[model samples]
Structures are given as C-alpha cells and as structure tokens.
Target: MGALLRGLVGLILSSVLVTSALAATAPVGGYTVVKAYPHDTAAFTEGLFYRDGFIFESTGLKGRSFIRKWNLETGVSEQERIVDSRYFGEGVVDWKNRLYALTWTDEIGIIYDIDSFERIGEFSYPGEGWALTRDDKRIMMSDGTSFIRFLDPETLKETGRIEVTDHGVPVRNLNELEWVKGELLANVWQTTRIARIDIKTGNVVGWIELAGLLKDAGVTGTQDDVLNGIAYDAVSDRLFVTGKLWPKLYEIKLAPAN
Candidate 1:
C-alpha cells in the first residue's frame, strides 16, 4: 500500500511539471522591436534608469561592479565608479536626490549622492536583492522571487509586499523591474518573456515575448543573456528592453494579440 501511494504522488508531481511546461510554451501575444541600440559588451548591466536627459546604468559581477553615466545619443560612458570586489551590486534607483543601490548577498543597501557617487548611508534588507523600481510614492523591490515589496522612500523600511501569480500559482524567478504607467514590468530569468504584473492584486496581466528580438539580434546564449533589463522614457513614454551582456537594447511597442 505504501509503494502504491508513493507511485501516485510521483504521478501527480510529473503532471504538475508537464502542465507548467505547457503554460510556459504557449504562444505569446504581440510585440515589436522598434529600434535597437548598441550596448557596451563589457557591462553586465544590472540597474538602468533615465534621468535628466541621459541614461544611468550599473553593472554587476564581483571585482567588476560599477555605476556609470551613459550618454544616450553616443552610448559612451562619461563617468563611472567601481564598487569593492566583495560586493556584488544589483538593483539601483534614484530617490529624493540620492541614489540607492542594493547588494547581492550582503543584505545591505547603500545610498549615494546622485552627482558625486559618494556613499551617504546604508540600510538592511531581508533577502538578496534582484531589482528596484519606484512609483513616486514608494520603492519597489524584488529578490529573485515572485514577491515584490514596497519600501518607504525616505527610511528604506518595508511597508508592504505582494506575491505575484498567474491563475493562483506563484510566478517564480522574477527579476529586473521597471514601473511604467501603473504596471510592473518584470524580466523572468532564463525565459524569453517580460511579464507585466499588477501590483495591487498580484495578477500577471500580460507578457511580451522576446523570441523575434533575440533572433534578430543574433543573441546566442544558454542562460545569462536571456531577457533582463527594462527602462521606460517618462517624457516620451517609450519602452526599452535588453539582456545581460546583450549587444543591443531595443525600443519596442506592444500590439494587441491577433
């Protein structure tokens, strides 16, 4: 009887895995890449933000992490500052005239003067950091999991969190976030999708698949080069997407599914 019960449980687990694979393989809605810009190959871009008519980007990896200011028109890094080899910096955001950056495993975040890149203060977090975004009121953070938390902009204290899901199941591996038009745009690591999630109710409202974009860009990679970075131009309201170590960042527009 025990053997039979074990067999039944194994069957159920296999069924669940199969169902999840199918759901992930389902055809995506509609998306088109409008423009592609050459991104520096040396930068494993972690954090990307648009401010004051230029792009501010941060790169990851121990012994090589750096925050730099890039000229959007020329794609040239004008100024940069590297972090110590011990810290693997992840997400970054500009808040209240300061720049806040999260570390990979130290469970600490650092604040810096936006113009000078000088460290001002540090705070603690519960888990490893993955991505950061803001909605004018609070800072949104992800820790390579389905849950996204809102932090107090001034104190960096957690105020609330939501477990992102699709059809009542946890959506794992959520990374690299951007808040645009009251929606959360997330890059699901190792996948060809950037999911648009609703913050209030934890529902995945839609997704934009990057199959065509990757194919066009000649991105041939097994894992790390999957869809990752996302930034939106607030003044123009245009969306941009890219990957880790990716050669190009594409400006895109979403179309209704046919």
Candidate 2:
C-alpha cells in the first residue's frame, strides 16, 4: 500500500509539471479601447498602417480592391488609387517612400509612389498573399498558412521564412500583420484573437484577445466582417485596429492577462 501511494503521488507531480509547462508557453493578453474614430463602412479593409499622420489602407474584393491614404481623425481618404479589376488586393505596406500592395491568388504585387499614389511597377511571387508588414530591413508576408515569408525590400524577392507555431502546434490562417516593437502581431482569420509572434523563433508567445471590440461599436455584421487590420504608429506608440465593414476604428492599449 505504501509503494502504490508513492507511485500515485509521482504521477500527479508529473501531470502538474506538464500543465505548468504548457501554461508557461502560452501567454494571454487583452486590450482596452483608448479612443474610437469613424471608419468607412464600405471598406473591406485588408491591410492598414500609419505613416506621416495618415492611415494608409488597402481594401479587398476583386474589382473593388484599391489603396488609399486616409485622414486619421475623420476616416476620409485624402488620396486613392483603384486597382485593376483582374486582381484582388490583399495587403499593403510602405517602405522607402514607396507603397507595396499584394494581391490574393494573383501571385503579383504592386508598387506605387507613396506621395503621388502612382503605380510604379509590379512584382511576382509564388502563393496567395494574405497580409504584408515590414521592419527596418525586410518585408514580411503571410499566405493564409502557418508560414511568414521575409522578402527583400529593394528587389521584392523572397529571402527567408518561418513556420509559426503555438506550443508545438502549427498556427495556420495567419492574416493581417504588423511589426510592433520587434514582435509580429497577426490577425488570425475568422477569429477575434491576435497572435503575438517572436520574429526570431517563429513561436507564438502571446495572444491578444479582442473579443467584443466590434460588437461594442454596434458592428453586428456577418462573418465577412470579422476582425482584420492592424496599424501601429511607432512615433506616437499608438496601436489602431479595425474590421471589414466596421464603422469605427479603435485605438487600443494592451492589458496583460491575469
């Protein structure tokens, strides 16, 4: 009887250690809306970023996909450029005075003059383009899969990639991306949570739960109106988010999970 009890205790200790290890791998987070600004309800926002006091956005849907520069306070477009009808826009980012826009399933991306919104050129890639973001040197892209690809800023060619994993499991369906403070923040498609990824290791270190953000703004749209779009203003240290067809853009501040 004494030996049996000792074995049971050892088993229980092993279970506890396993549970604690899993908990340590997955960190959770939340957010509070600091402010809300009106957004165009017609926009199917796929990519968003802040620069030079303007919110640069790319809206999707074939024949409706376009890029625009928006006024941050009023959500009004100061400049716009319509994409070709044959392409479906996916994501966009700005680098070195140029704006790059990606197309879903088209295997192509567009480059434009940031100030003039004029199409400068186009580049080709291999897979579907789900989202785009950039750090100082490399452009990062997602393809609705578990992988994030790093591309050359000047040549717009694939340089490297990493498969995103959460606690030894692959995390797929990675959507809109934004590089924030050395971490890659991604909106997983069809979910209310955002994954905060370690760029070097490709591990999901934390998740930012954004539940009820759109609903609180009275956005009761369909599944197509799911959460998307993340824009970070490095200068002001402000983070902004919006959804497809959402009427309000929220400025959020992160709160650590309990």
lDDT of 1 by residue, 1-258 (tens): 999999999999999987885475322576777888878777787888878767777778999888888777678887787877899988888997899898888999988898888888899998899889998899999999889999999999999999988766678988888999999988888888877888999888877777787777677646566667888898998888777788887889988643
Tell me how candidate 2 scores on lDDT: 0.92
What's each prediction's TM-score?
0.89, 0.90
Model 1 scores what on Cα lDDT?
0.83
Q: Model 2 Cα displacement at 51 (Å)?
A: 0.1
Point out where model 1 deviates above 4 Å: 1-27
Clashes of each: 0, 0
lDDT per residue (tens digit) for residues 1-258 in model 2: 999999999999999877865666567899989999888888899999999999999999999888989999998899999999998888999999899999999899999999999999999999899999999999999999999999999999999999998886788999999999999999999888899999899999999988879678676545788899999999999999999988989999999965
Residue 204 displacement (Å), model 1? 0.3
> What's the lDDT for residue 202 in model 2?
94
Which pairs clash in the backbone of model 1?
none
